[model samples]
Target: MKMIIATLAAVVLMTTSTVAFAEQFEVINTEGSSVPGCQVTNSCFIPHTLTISVGDEVIWKNADVATHTVTSGTQRGGPDGVFNVSPFFPEDAFSHIFDEPGEYPYYCLVHPWMKGLVIVQDAMADDDNAETTPPPDDGDQKSQMDEQRATPTYDAEHFVTTWIISTPGESIIIPTGELTGTYSVDWGDGTITTEAGNAIHEYDDAGNYTVQVYGDFTSIRLGGDPTNAVKLHSIDQWGMIQWTTMESAFRGASNMVYGATDVPDLSNVTDMSHMFAHAHSFNGDISTWDVSSITDMSSMFASATSFNQPLESWNISSVTAANGMFRGASLFNQPIDSWNTSSFMDTSFMFLDAVSFNQPLDSWDVSSVTEMSYMFTHATSFNQPLDSWDVSSVISTSSMFWFAESFNQPLDSWDVSSVIDMERMFESAHSFDQDLSEWHIIPDGT
Candidate 1:
């Protein structure tokens, strides 16, 4: 009985030791280490590599002043799942548990060059089996992994296409399987006279269609004036182009000439928001556009990388929504003080990732904005007069200036009395210094 009891005691000690050993994976940043390779000084993990076992958790503690993220693998790196830890603040820690056996690599979406790999090994697999499997083929594995991570690809041809419209009162059938074509309109009865042409095409078909009104620039008349003037009076009578097909139509005739100077005529356009949001090569001047009827300007130029038209002259006094309006527009740098955004609520990423904008927005009224999280994040050089703006209504300022490297303006005038989460608000802002002595923090006694 005594021998059996001693054996059981020994087994309990061994089990405890194993449990403690299993939870031993830890990630640390080396002090004063700025080297750019694996095992930089005291840091165990580099940009894209970490090794651990099943049931083990890896904790990432930010030691440097610069913010870092652990986003899923991108184009340069390998497969990384949806788990992301971004804008990690100094002393802030994030832990992820590895339950399965696989190699997971991640990168910093904000800083793409930073990479890290997490290898989860099976507790039961022998060391010999692990060594013999050979590191997964980087070429084939990357392709397969990318396929799994691919977002739905949109076909432009399926939505927008060309067509021909016959005169004032004729039903035109669109050619089958043709995604696009030119539509020529000729006054059928001649009573309307092809010389005094002002005909509209009605596309009852459900898909996106690029309707091109072909006419002599010197032949058409609007008010009996012999000027090649085109007018789309109403939204109902005007052609409707959905977002899905807009890309294809824009690309097909992306370089097509329209106006007198080969410019596209958008003077009568009421809703200009989201018109060219995802258009890659839509580099036309719509500075004189009448956008007085537009209310939502959200995501209007979100990812338009090459658009640099001067739209400061546009009449956007009626625009109420500017959410994500300039999210990823890296080239546009025109003044937008003409916009009337009194009704905006969510300005979360209004200028996030916009690297070239450095204008003064101190005169605008942002009293109604609630979410300012990441509003100016990654806007490298956007440091100017924003001191007059009201931030009393803001709630989430979590990542408001996470990676704004060149933002060093004084924000003492901001009323953050209503803000809740201030975590990582100034993280990775390599050049940020604002006095927060006036900010109303919750009383320590209360």
Candidate 2:
């Protein structure tokens, strides 16, 4: 009995390690979990089964109205003692790292009908084979720094984001994250630190210096704080760090930051809300970014005055909340009609004060949108067709087209019966004269 108990304890032990090349995956606990039909179709968790690498992390966002638990083990087998999130409310999130290689099943305590499985495979097996490979000639081989820059950084080997700081008294502060892993920071001024908890490293003299950070991280938020964002000169190398959220990463960065322009591995990122808010003068080459995994892009480029990059290739199929995505971007006028918004629900303040945005968005799938309050307020140059929208799921359209001077599109074919708030929906000096007498308001609407 003692040996059996010890074996069970070992299986549930938490082993945390940072890997640079690991990926991030997200699983939604889907809406309407309080009912019984979700289990019949195996749709409690979207993509009921997920497979990931050992070092990869799985973030679970609770979309159901009721609070649910993501406890390891089935309702019949009881708790396996692997991991458990007691009670997470609607819109809350819980994440777990799969350090061991095996199949781990998790179920909801509140609702036994909900179940999901995760298969973790060891990603280090390929690294062993890479060691047996022959090396290149001396002339063809690059330096250690060059090799690090040319490849993705991860915990499997070792690499970090190489930052170039040229100003004296300038500091870089590192923020804390959810998971605990070993982090090393090389200040490049003979100071090497292993702790990455709100680490504020200051340069005493003005000179070109390289700062490298190696480790596993999930959230590197407001990387350079709002007050010290100007001090951040450049991120010479953005290593392959499996980040889950980049929200407010550069909240108030100035134009001096000329890096972070490379196409990063963003397969696991979910929340990008306020990522580049107030980042004036930032016009980088990020036209090829894969944005398929992003769910929250609220205020992503808000107040970014000089950003006009081509973003027609971004896969935004998974986005759900895009509130204020391009708000106050005075000079941005990119064509993004080909993007997918089938999963979008909340797009409030999406284009508020975006004066130069006049593109074709007739092909967008906004049938899933709910709250469109202030979506196009002050967007003076927008004129498009939105007559085929299925607005039966929307509850609020307050100030939706307020102050949009050039919009005179036909929206008479919309179903406004579900909208409870339509105050000032088209209130402005606008040319909108469409007949809305056929539209019916909800019972509780004004």
Candidate 3:
């Protein structure tokens, strides 16, 4: 009888020990348990409070149907970078071992009202481990606040001083100020020249010819042989041209700045996108100004019917898009082989109907481009070497080579792995006969 009692006592003791050691909980998205402020709909966590010892592991099994995150902080404040466990799917379990004794307040990221707390108590208080330096200063640390409320520098109220001077019969464009780099001038008459101080030219007839300058000059004025005809043209109404300082100040003056002979200070401009988009008469020397801060160059020279200038010295690394940039610009064909196009993403409709752009772009880094639809459509004179371009990231090639009658380069070396939409890609491309049997086409274009 005594032996039987001992065996029964041993079994009961073993069951109690197993229950005490295993600290487990479940997170449920159900009605709250009768706690004071915890409600049914908002109380995401099943048991909102838990107590555990140091060196003990806690397992949280998600019983909710939706995903939940065990982030550390209150709903009003942001995350505290503590133990953040997220994406706990239905029936998924997450475990974490407590190494220190402290009160850890946690809340769900998705459901902020579903708050919980884990109170960890030391198994044994060691005096030597308790005495340490003070915690870090919260005030000294950098706050991870949103930066959208910062002060803006570029307001539309400020006006940039610009003047227009036209020379009726003079055929000479002279560089006056202390010129540093080499200045290139496109004489609008299909003639390009490089000079230091004074650039002289002879026009075949007396017609309005826009001369483009490509050098650095500050505080210089342009005049037409001491004639009143070289006065400031109409300043026009200040429209949506928002800028802090105009680098290409008169870029918005379409075709009017063509008569101006002086170059403005373009050293402080940041946004040069669409600056000379429709400036049909502006063939000035702007090749020497600093353009490092310029971000958007989308359609900078689009529809400029008579612009064919050399832009090889330009550093376009900071530009992000060139969409419809040179579209309908019939006379632009200069050597832009040295331009850095690594940052451009959207080149869609960039060279649409540009019939005279056939420069060699074999060395341009177009690896980041994702859209090339309508890029070379209607560009009849583009037959340069583009076989070595890395087109793995391009998604849409629809109507890319449409109506390109002069493009016959072998594109067998390009990686067209990521292209999804290729509808009408080579339609009307009478000159494209290269074999494309190795292209990996996606089934559903999503």
Candidate 4:
């Protein structure tokens, strides 16, 4: 089952500027070493070394849990005047351009042993002719070499794209060359629209935002502060896409995304435990997402107070844990009777303080669940049918219905033989007057 065994570690660095570039090279810091070509014990920067033209750019992306730097120079020599990175966290990246022809060796200040090299070459040296015509205009004027390099190279997996904040609360997006399709845009402020000439948008407040674009697109990276958007609107094909398909794509966003109309496909997602833990403004229509691949749904909607959408059609057969799935969700009372809970092993605090939940779950198969402690603590409106549930596998039912004022269901037939704790099972259940003469209780560790 999908589980969040460790928290995602990173330090996000914000930027207020953008730069144009030519060919772009990527170096990812994954696991303990760089990937795609880099290895540890010897060469740490995948490719270890690289050769590029004077105008090319190289981007270093952090894919590990720890921080990494791309300081220019070796450990003993210290940092050079070339480049250096501020503490960048997981999924963070930094780029630099080479304009001079020379050999530059770089290393990571955090991990002194990690190193890399970049060799810059003169543009004219690439031509076969010893003395090329007019020295091939170099940025000073338009030349034949410039036209040759203009031919765009598109990736089968990712379409070339770029975006920038046009002004306060607005952004200008450009999907250049080869990629053609009417796309939909989610401004990340409870608003969505279609892409026109140069996709533009405005936001309500001034803060960091992630603009999501979908349609004939495979990869999306919209990073900017859309504080200067206009009120123009249009529609396109956005129903076929699911925005969270990529890995850890929207980890800690608060009000950045809202409404069900903007979420894309989720058939391939595995870990979504804290996807929206503290997102207090998300009440979107994501009931149609395929959640069969998910295993860890703990705290998925913990503090999302405005969410009350229907999720009865979701297939949760592979789920194994839902520790705090609805801890503080105060307005969720949807019918989830059709959920497949046979593989659930942990439901601790699943509905800790959900004051408005009272759905029927009589047909649920919960034979594999072992922890139901505080499952319905403080759930004032929950009084549903759960008599047919096979909870013989549960080990902790302490405070299971504590403070559940309206829960008066008859549980005399339940096999509580395996429960090791039953303290405060019905502590403040003012409405519970059912007979418990047939209960088979036991203490912790016999």
Index of the highest-TM-score prediction: 2
Estimate the lDDT of model 3.
0.58
- Residue by residue across 1-446, what tens digits does model 3's lDDT show? 00101110001111121222335444443433223354444365656777877745555656655655566555433344345443334555555555468987777654556788778887754487566543354223212111211222222322122222323454443424343345555665788777665556766653334444554322121222323222222222232322233323334344232212233334455555565655544454556655666766666777766567677888888777878878877777888878899998988988998999999988989999998999999999999889889998999889999999999988888888799888999999999999987776668764
lDDT (Cα) of model 2: 0.71
For candidate 1, write residues 163-238 as lDDT tens digits.
2221333333222122233334432222221222234444443211233333232111121211111111001111
Error of 2 at 240 (Å): 2.0
Model 4, 140-257: lDDT tens digits are: 4333323422323322222222122223655444321223356666665677786643465655553334445656543222212222111111111234443332322222333232
Descending-TM-score candidate ranking: 2, 4, 3, 1
Model 3, residue 19: what's the lDDT?
Answer: 22
Clashes of 1: 14
**Clash number by candidate, in order:** 14, 4, 10, 21
Better of 2 and 4 by TM-score: 2
Q: Which structure is stronger by lDDT: 3 or 4?
A: 4
Cα lDDT, all candidates: 0.51, 0.71, 0.58, 0.61
Runs in model 1 with CA error above 4 Å?
1-273, 442-446
Q: Please tell me which model should have the higher TM-score, number 1 or number 2.
A: 2
Off by over 4 Å in 4: 1-253, 256-263
